[model samples]
Structure formats: C-alpha cells, structure tokens
Target: MTYTTEIIINKPRKEIIKTFEDSSLFPHWQRGLKRSRVISGKAGEEGSKRRLYINIEGQSIKMTETIIKKNLPEEWHGQYTSKGMKSIQKNYFEALDDHKTKWTSQSEFEFSGFMKLISKLLPDMFKKRSVMVQQDFKTFIEEGKPVKTN
Candidate 1:
C-alpha cells in the first residue's frame, strides 16, 4: 500500500530538518521507540543501517533502517524492514516562509508472511500510524518538546 500525508510545521525548514536528523530526539516523537543504534556505516550517511527496537502496544518489535537518500532541508528517503513487513519512506520539506515549513511524506509498504493477513484485515492501521507519527513530529518541532512518550 502507498499513501501520502503532510503537515505544516510552524518552524523553518532548517530547524525542522535539524531536529529530524538528530537520532537522540527520535524517541521523543516516535511514541513507541524503545532504543536505536547505528549498526553499520556512519550515522546519517546514505547506506547507513540502524537497528531500532519499538514497543508497540506492549509487544516488542525490531526493525532495521537504512538511509536511502539524505538531501537535507529538501528531501530524505529511507527503507525499513521488520519481520514480515517492508516499507520505503520518501520525505520532502518545503519552506513556506521564514518561519513556517511544509512537510510531506510518501510511504509504501509491502507485507509478507503473517503480516499479509494483518494488512488485508486492517489496512487503515498503517495509514493511521503514519499520520500519527507525522503529527507527533509536528508537535515536537512546534512545541520544542515531545508530546508523546516512548
């Protein structure tokens, strides 16, 4: 499945991108994230891989993240793989003005094994999760703090 979601952040694109690139700040906006570490390559560089542990609804989920593209303040792309799901995320940022930015994301997900069944049964869940994460990031950038707990 594929979809796009967007939000307007009341901050400059540079500021938003700064926060987005900081791995230390991820746990704040990514509500379920438990821990993350770079397993190979230099952090933030294309081809770098990061392992993430997320506690989703009391279940521990693990995923490997690879940076696909890193054109900051303009675009970023990444791929994420978990047990039965794979996702590619393309993110774009546009400066609306001196103090406002527009964030857009195009996400595609493919399910296999057991997740295929879950995907068919609750397709909206993926979309909802994507939007929720975007909103959380918006709140974090605008308010200068994480609104959701990890």
Candidate 2:
C-alpha cells in the first residue's frame, strides 16, 4: 500500500528541519515511541540504522529503521522493517514563506504473513497513523505540545 500525507507547520523550514533532524526530539511527537537508539553507522547519515521500540494500545512493537537518504531541509528517505512489514518513507520539506513550512510524506508498505491480511483489511489505519504523526509534529512545533503517553 502507498499513501501520502501533508501538513503545514507554522515555523521556518530551517527551524523545522533542526527539530526534525534531532533524534532526541522524536519521542515528544511520536506518541507511542518508547525508545530510539542508533544501532550502526552514524545517526542521521545514509545507511545508519536505528532500533525503535513502541507501544500501541497494550502491544509492544519493535522496528528497525535504516536511513536511505538524508538531504536535509529538502528531503529524507528511510526504510523501516518490523516483524511482518516493511515500509519505505519519503519526506519532502518546502518553505512556503518566511514563517511557514510544508511537510509531505509518502509511504509505501509491503506486508507478509498476517500483516498482509491486516493491511488489506485496514488500509486506512496506516494512512490515519501517518496523518496523526504529522499532526502531532505540527502541534509539537507550533504549540509546544508533546504527545501524551501513559
């Protein structure tokens, strides 16, 4: 499955990129993220790998993310793999003006095993999650609101 999501952030592109590129800030916006740690290569560089632990509802999930491209303030691409799914995410950033920035995210997912059936049954779930994350990011940047986690 493939989908795209877009959001306009009320911040300069450079400011948004600064916060986006900082791994330490991820958990503030990614509601369920419990931890993120670099596993290989260099953080934020192409080919770097990171391990992400997340909790959704009552389920614990582990995912590995590998940076595919990092152009900064312009574009970034990453491949994320989990137990039965792989996702390729491409992100684009544009400066709409001096104080507004546009973020566009394209996601492609490949599922296997049970995840394949789930993907077919709940395709909108993936897209909704992406939109939620993007909205969370906008809130984080504009309103200083971090995702509330229990």
Candidate 3:
C-alpha cells in the first residue's frame, strides 16, 4: 500500500532539516521509538543501516533501517524492514517561507506472511501511524515538546 501525508512545521527548512537529520531527536518525535543503533556505514548517510527498537502497544517490535538516498535539506529516502514487512519512505521538504516548511512523505509498504493479512485487514493503521508521527514531529520542531504516545 502507498499513501502520502504531510505536515507544516513552523520552522525554517534548514532548522527542520537539521532537526530531522538528528537521530538523537528521533525518539522524541517518533512515537513508540525506544532506541536505535547503527550497524554499518555512517549513521545518516546512504547505505547505512540501523536497528530500531520500538514499543508498540505492549509489543516490542524491531526493524532494520537502511538509508537509500540522502539529499540534505530536501529529501531523505529509506527502507525499513521488519519480520514480514518492508516499508519505503521518501520524505520531501519544502520551504513555504522564511519561517515555515512543509514536510511531505510518500510511503509504500510491502507485506508477506502474516503481515500481509494484517495489512489487508488494517490498512489504515499504517497511514494513521504515519500521520501521528508527522504531527508529533511538527509539535516537536515548533514547540520543542515531543508528544510521547507511549
């Protein structure tokens, strides 16, 4: 499945890009994110891989993230692989003005095994989670307050 979601951050594109690129700030905005550790290459550069530990509901989910493309302040594309799911997220940032930026994400998910059933049964779950993260990021960058859902 594929969908697009966007959020307007009340910050300049440069600041938004810088903050988004900081892995240290991920847990603050990415709901349920517990921790991440780089396994290969440079942390944020293309071809780098990281293991992400996230607690969703009461389940501890683990996923591997591999950066596919990185164009600072404009685009960052990556693929996240989990047990039965592979998600490709392409993010774009546009400066609306000197003080505001628009962040858009084009996300696609491929599923197999049991996750295929889950995805078919609850497609909106993925989309909802994506939007939630975007909204949380907006709040984080604009107000410096990360809305922790867990």
- The CA root-mean-square deviation of candidate 2, after full C-alpha superposition on the true structure, stands at 1.3
Q: TM-scores, in order shown?
A: 0.96, 0.97, 0.96
Alpha carbon lDDT of each predicted model: 0.92, 0.94, 0.92
Candidate 3 has what TM-score? Answer: 0.96
Q: For residues 1-150, what per-residue lDDT tens digits would candidate 3 score against the true structure? A: 999999888899999888889999998999889999999999899999999999987889999999999997899999999999999999999999999999999999999999999998998999999999999898888778877632
**What value does the lDDT take at residue 137 in candidate 2?**
92
Comparing 2 with 3 on lDDT, the higher-scoring candidate is 2
TM-score, candidate 2, is 0.97
Q: Please give the distance, in angstroms, between residue 28's alpha carbon in candidate 2 and its true position after superposition.
A: 0.4
Whole-model alpha-carbon lDDT for candidate 2: 0.94
lDDT of 2 by residue, 30-126 (tens): 9899998999998899999999999976789999999999998799999999999999999999999999999999999999999999998988989
| Whole-model lDDT, model 3 | 0.92
Q: Rank by lDDT, highest first.
A: 2, 3, 1
Give the C-alpha miss distance for residue 25 in model 1, angstroms.
0.6
